[model samples]
Target: MFINFIWLNVFLMLCAWLWVSYNKRAGLVDVIWAFGIALNVILASLIFETAPLMVRVFLAVASGIWFLRLAWHLLRRYCHETEEDTRYANMRRAMGKYQHLGFLAFFLFQAGLIVLFSYPMLALLNIPMEQWGSSTIIYLVVAAIIMLVAFWGESLADEQLYRFKQNPENKAKTMDQGLWRYSRHPNYFFEWLHWFAYPIIGLAAGVYSLWIYPILMFLFLYYVTGIPFSEQQALQHRGDNYKDYQRRTSIFIPWQPKE
Candidate 1:
């Protein structure tokens, strides 16, 4: 059922992308629907078996809240956006006649990401949560704090970038203010960090999956649908300034800029 659910999304998104790729952008509606679907999958997973009811409930609430928040933020920002995400635009351009294949690859990759990071939610139903211990409590507390910090960082970074781009004078300029001053992609960093928190909570609840969280982060930051390809698009669009920014700024970590 889980695998089928995952593939259902992948197939639907792939089909949609084929028709919409040339005419429109991926919208917030789709993002919200995706989040809701993922949450539903996780919730359904909990009902099948495994884990103390309290533990499963707690993890489900935590994950559901986080996902909903992310979906809200993304939806609001993309509300008026008509442009294809630069990532998709560049992808379409580079692939040209092979854009259909590119769409399938990216669509499936996204579904895979949704499934991988969601392992904690799904895997819990396969393992008993009564195995939770004192050490797991510590991990959960620390993870909760990290969740706040990561989500906050992502929020501030996005707000700063948004405001910067709003100014006519800064329209053509590279953003180097606020969180952007510290990291080239603060939002992406937090997005990666977000996945770690879930696994920690899952671990705390005595729910474990084989490398699900780490693999999700690794692929998101390095390969498939992540930064390497993204940076290439940025370089082409932002010109040498983005290249200079890359040299001076941390690619994935948040820190004060060097003097």
Candidate 2:
């Protein structure tokens, strides 16, 4: 079943790559990833009989809502976009003659990530029902709180930035109000925080391997795709203003901004 899931993701992403290659809207990669991961997690819960029905139901509801919200947010932004996103546009330009092949590889990389992240969910859903204990409740409560905070934090940061950008006067200006005042990338921070929920729950189920998700997410956000590229783009457009904001704001965590 896992092998089938992987093949299906690969095939779906291949189709997505074809569409993106024609439309030149590479941001659709994010929308597809969000929805695909949600579907994968929910489907795993439904088919995996090792976990209790209630636990499976909870996992389905929580993960479905979280990823669906993100997918919709990305889709809405995609609809309003007048051109390809700058990141992808730059990447394509860099690729020059090999743009098509490069994008195909990038899309397939997203497919691989979908499979990798889904492993934790699969592990959680496979926990035997009889293993539920007093500690499980404690872990679930903590995990639920983390999920709520992460959801609201990311949503608020995205909405705040969206509103700030909607103003014509704010073009090329850095956002320093609301959550953005505390962290240069509050959205990315909360996104990394969201992964911690799984590790917390995994403790109750003796699934220590789940801890890797949060660590992997942190690395991805801090050093790889999240802050580095975003800050570089900001610096390119906003110049010294973004650098000043970076000086004052925390890179990954919410904190009091510097004077």
Candidate 3:
């Protein structure tokens, strides 16, 4: 399969870090810290080795597209912005003398996560879950539709926020219109939703043994990088307005804002 071993993941992580470092953005890497995830985005395909040809193609293309999207989104988020992301500033200070150690630990753990998050890739990579039949086409079409929904949701959310940020008048306030009106973190919510398509299609194949795909995403959204990290940043930046937004808006699901 495309992802044979953890070594590939490690290599990918290092490459990401190297790219970040080359750009003099190692600090950004420390803060936004996206390299670890690229590995997950790619390694998820390791499971395709045993999957049906149709299933494998779907997984590979889905994952490839997903990674490209995420990579572009994050790069746009972090690149060219000189702000130290606040998240990394505290982390770097906390690391102190062992900051180098912190980067290593963070990168390695993210490598594992890349492995962890790519469960659909593992589930559908090489497993003969579906044959080239009507079922396969249905799976592909469904997956593609879900993927488009997910892609659009994320892209629109990011675009809206980017434009909001660009407007000089919107500074120091919370974004409570557009997609932001419904979900406190529209981009992140959709980012998690994107993972659902994989399993919807992966299960259509035959790999049900690994359920880590959905569970980890759920956990990540609530506990890890999703709400936890974003909320922390929001509290620091937006303060009371953000708190009100959180109280009125759905944390995970998309819905109308409180009237």
Return the top candidate by lDDT: 2
Runs with alpha carbons beyond 4 Å of true place in candidate 3: 1-5, 16-50, 129-134
- Write the residue-wise lDDT of candidate 1 on 1-259 in tens digits: 6776677666656665665665656453347344754576456656666655554565666667667777776776676566877765676788889877766676767667666556566665556555666576577677778777877887788788877866888754788888888888898888777667766766665556644776667675767656887688777778887878887888777776766
Residue 98 accuracy (lDDT) in model 3: 82
- TM-score winner between 1 and 2, please give it: 2
In Å, residue 259's CA in model 2 sits off its true spot by 2.2
- Number of clashing residue pairs in every model? 2, 0, 15
The C-alpha TM-scores of every prediction are 0.78, 0.95, 0.84
Model 3 TM: 0.84
What lDDT is obtained when candidate 2 is compared to the true structure?
A: 0.88
Better of 1 and 3 by TM-score: 3
Worst 10 residues of 2 by lDDT: 129-138
Model 1 residue runs over 4 Å out of place are 7-22, 26-38, 45-49, 93-109, 134-136, 205-212
The 10-residue segment with the lowest total lDDT in model 1? 25-34
Q: What are the runs in model 2 whose C-alpha is more than 4 Å off?
A: 131-134
